[model samples]
Target: MHPRIRLELAKRWSEPHREHHDTDHLAEVVRAVDLLASSGMAFDIDTVNTAAWFHDAVYDVHRADNVERSATLAQRWLGPGEGDRIAQVVMATTDHVAATGDVESAVLCDADLSILGADTERYDRYAHAIRVENLHVPDAEYRRLRSRVLARYQARSELFATAAARELWEDQARENLARELTRLGRPVAV
Candidate 1:
């Protein structure tokens, strides 16, 4: 079921024309969803996986409210009840307050952050890919923008809510955030 939903999401948004919301990103999110599922977190994996696949489907490089757009799309796909919950998880992904959200949302949030714990080379590649994806933005603008985003990411200690997530990923994520912040010239004060 989730696989079919993922296919639907990929069909809608993972075209060659787009940069950020591509098949690779969808795959990564799906992997994270699976990790969360295996971590014993109580979540509707079907809904969360579907939401993860579509969370960035409508992202605009310059627009800030893609979460709302993503949530709307998920809601429409889900219809009442379950759709509402799916929408909430998608919304939680949108740079908002995920730590205080529902249990499912918290799990989803951890899944999303799992990338931060990836191997350094892989994480570096992801950053480079993001830059290429948003190539319309000038280098200086990208640097500042990336710095702000990385800083915000590092500011949170509650990066992953589930116990397994915290135990497995918290340190690595912080390390990644530190490395990224240093590269972006916003290194945390020692």
Candidate 2:
């Protein structure tokens, strides 16, 4: 990674309106990718780390095109081949679903979502941060939409696509989602 790119990314993530999608979240995803790579996981570490830095670069809580815009931003800094791959990884975070058979994409997605399995205190802080980011929405509406989003992950048979991620974080992620749903007055789907 170039120093210039790192500096640019830091600036983008430091935007004042960002609450959850700030530099801290970017660092967490990068750290998660590093941890996964250190554990002997076979994937392109550079691509995953690059994707992590640019994934939320264009975040806008009220905008639906953040993922697409983020991918486009990647193209400006990365070469065609690497940029395309990073774009795909960035887009994958939008749905937390990777392209079938794409290991790098799976790893990137898992790293981006690592927050879901964070311990109770950290998870609580993440939840609070997200709520702050979406403060424009009414409390009831926020709860409704947030519940749906969390339930979507909870209802999935597997929260993580990577084997290591599933083994390490699946149970905890499910527990966190379930507890959050309960607090939101949304019944956890069976």
Candidate 3:
């Protein structure tokens, strides 16, 4: 990665109000992608890494266009071919829905969502961290919105796109989501 791009990404993710979407989260995703690649999963590592670094580069709780803005930022910094690939990968994080046959995008999506399968303590912290990020919202409203978001993921037949990710994370991710939903006073899906 270019030093300038690294610096810019650092600056954006370092925003004081960000709790879960900070540089640490970016590093975690990068590490996850690297691990998957090292295990012989075939994908454009460079593009995946680039996308990981920029995926949450423009996070805003109130903004639905953060993914588009992040994609544009990637294009601006990385230029066409690679940038476009990175942008597509970043966009995949918007809904965590990679197109069929797009392994690279699937890997990127899996990497971004890896935290969902973390241990109970860590997952709890992640949930709290997100609440902190959206601190402006009332508790009840946040719970409702957060429940809806988790429900969307839970409703998916497959939570992780890549086989490796699915094998490793699917069950744990579903368990974690159910736990969270119960905590939020929402009924978990069967």
* 10 residues in a row with least lDDT, candidate 1: 12-21
TM-score of each: 0.87, 0.96, 0.96
Comparison by lDDT, 1 against 2, better one: 2
Model 3 C-alpha lDDT per residue in residues 1-190, reported as the tens digit of each score: 8988999899999999899999888888988898788878988898788788899899888888999999999998999887888888899888999999888889999998999988889889999999999998999999999999999999999998888888777889999999999999999889
lDDT of each: 0.75, 0.90, 0.90
Clashes of each: 0, 0, 0
On residues 69-186, what C-alpha lDDT tens digit does candidate 2 reach at each position? 9999998788788888789888888898998988888999999889999998999999999999999999999999999999889888899998888877888898899999999999
Q: Higher-TM-score candidate among 1 and 3?
A: 3
Q: Can you write out model 1's per-residue Cα lDDT over 37-76, one digit (the tens) per residue?
A: 7867677787777677767877677787878988888778
Prediction 2 global C-alpha lDDT: 0.90
| Pairs that collide, model 1 | none
